[model samples]
Target: MKLATYLDGSRDGQLVVVSRDLSQAHFANGIATRLQQVLDDWAFMAPQLEELSISLNHGRCRHAFAFNPAQCMAPLPRAYGWTVPEDGGRRASDALLGPHAPLRLLADPVPCAARYAVLHGDVPRGIDALSARDAIRLLLLAAESPTHTAFAPVAVSPDELGAAWQNGRVMLPVLAMHNGRREGGTDKPEPGADFGRLLSDLAHPRALRAGSLVGATTAVLVPAMAAGDAVRFEVKDEAGHSIFGAIEQDVVLEGTATE
Candidate 1:
């Protein structure tokens, strides 16, 4: 959904979603949900956490209290993913305290498998034509007054969105539940087990099973041209030296132009 968290600083317990528009959409678990989704044999963060060591991968920062549900309405910075930590690196809440953080739904928060099926199947076939921006817009419109359309949540990060899709995980329409229930049953996308391997498979599907980037390739991409989308691009020549190159990609929604 077109969701954004507004945190009130200079005060405690003042965290509330400033925009009624967003709250109406879906004030999801936000950071908490994201952290939980990715913890995977890793550390878990919570408020008042101490004396616990969190092992993080190189260049990967740990998200401690950054996942607080109470910190939703905090401001986000111009540069993405920067949060305001509280209690000396032990805890953190949202930063960039204000409105206008460009909140919007970036994807269908449905089960990853279902969403994938929609994107790969129904989307291209014209059953549902939505870009990440369109999804957010639909959410915002629905939130504005539940009469516009059905609601869906937006992801704070494209990777988070991709991770949900890669894992074929889904947030409940109005609730969240996980109890080993096989969602979508025989219709869910195949889970890749881990992020790194999933990403590798996504990037080079052909190199994986079926000998092509097109087979069973459930990778989802939020191209840079789309709203609330960003990516890191690395270039290397035949010798592995850095070199500039042009890359072309597209998200072929039913109503959008093909890239």
Candidate 2:
């Protein structure tokens, strides 16, 4: 079933089960209140959620409203743990933000492709996938480094749009710009390690799992960014329809890049 966190006119929005066509929604009341809450108890909550989806689809419920992608938040507002393989960092940042992100890459964000994944649950049972539906998320951050990023306001999950890992790649449809150069492409990264591997990785020294990951893309490209540059990204469905909507990355204090 499709799920999202929408503005209920508050800071932490209400959790909702959106329609497949992206037209309507029914609030996930009682059963669950937030996306993280659902993720935290997927095995217990999913069955109940499935029933709610059925009821909403049958028009047997009230408290429903017109679904608005513009009023959505990242499926996971703040990821439990966010990791980008060696070179994919720059591209992930650029595509996630914008080409003008002002990334000061100590190393070229090319040559070495990487893996991306989201882990939730626990070290032993890390469930991974960005979203059951391909989603659009934005990260806006300003730090001492030109490349630091943070989560933005708008994020959308339209249900069942996320690409399944094929052969060994997860496609991240991307638009990038660098010094007036514009390009479009995909990023393929293994979502995350298997359960056993995840446990092993987390078992390493100083390896306390921070948050649960949801999903990720690979082959992200790194673009040169500046202080005033803007970074925007969107995730579309197989038919190229906006699922996550539009995320415009803004740079307030684009820092300088270092060696």
lDDT of 1 by residue, 1-259 (tens): 1123324343221211111112222222433322222222113422201111111112132342222322332222121211111111111222322211222233422122111111111011121212211211111101110011111222222122322333332221211112222212222224522322322333332221110111122222222223223212212223432111111112122344322
Model 1, stretches more than 4 Å misplaced?
1-6, 9-66, 74-154, 163-259
TM-score: model 2 vs. ground truth: 0.57
Stretches of model 2 off by over 4 angstroms after superposition: 8-12, 54-61, 85-119, 125-163, 167-169, 175-211, 214-218, 254-259
Write model 2 residue lDDT over 1-259, tens digit each, in one string: 5666665655446778766555678888778887667666667886787788777767766877787656665445545544442323312322222112233344433221122343344332232332211222111111112344423222322224455433223344444433344444444422433323333434443333333442333323433444445545444456765443434444444244422
TM-score per prediction, in order, is 0.19, 0.57
Report residue 185 deviation for candidate 2 (angstroms).
1.9
What are the clash counts of all predictions, listed in order? 16, 27
**Each candidate's lDDT (Cα)?**
0.21, 0.44
Top-lDDT candidate index: 2
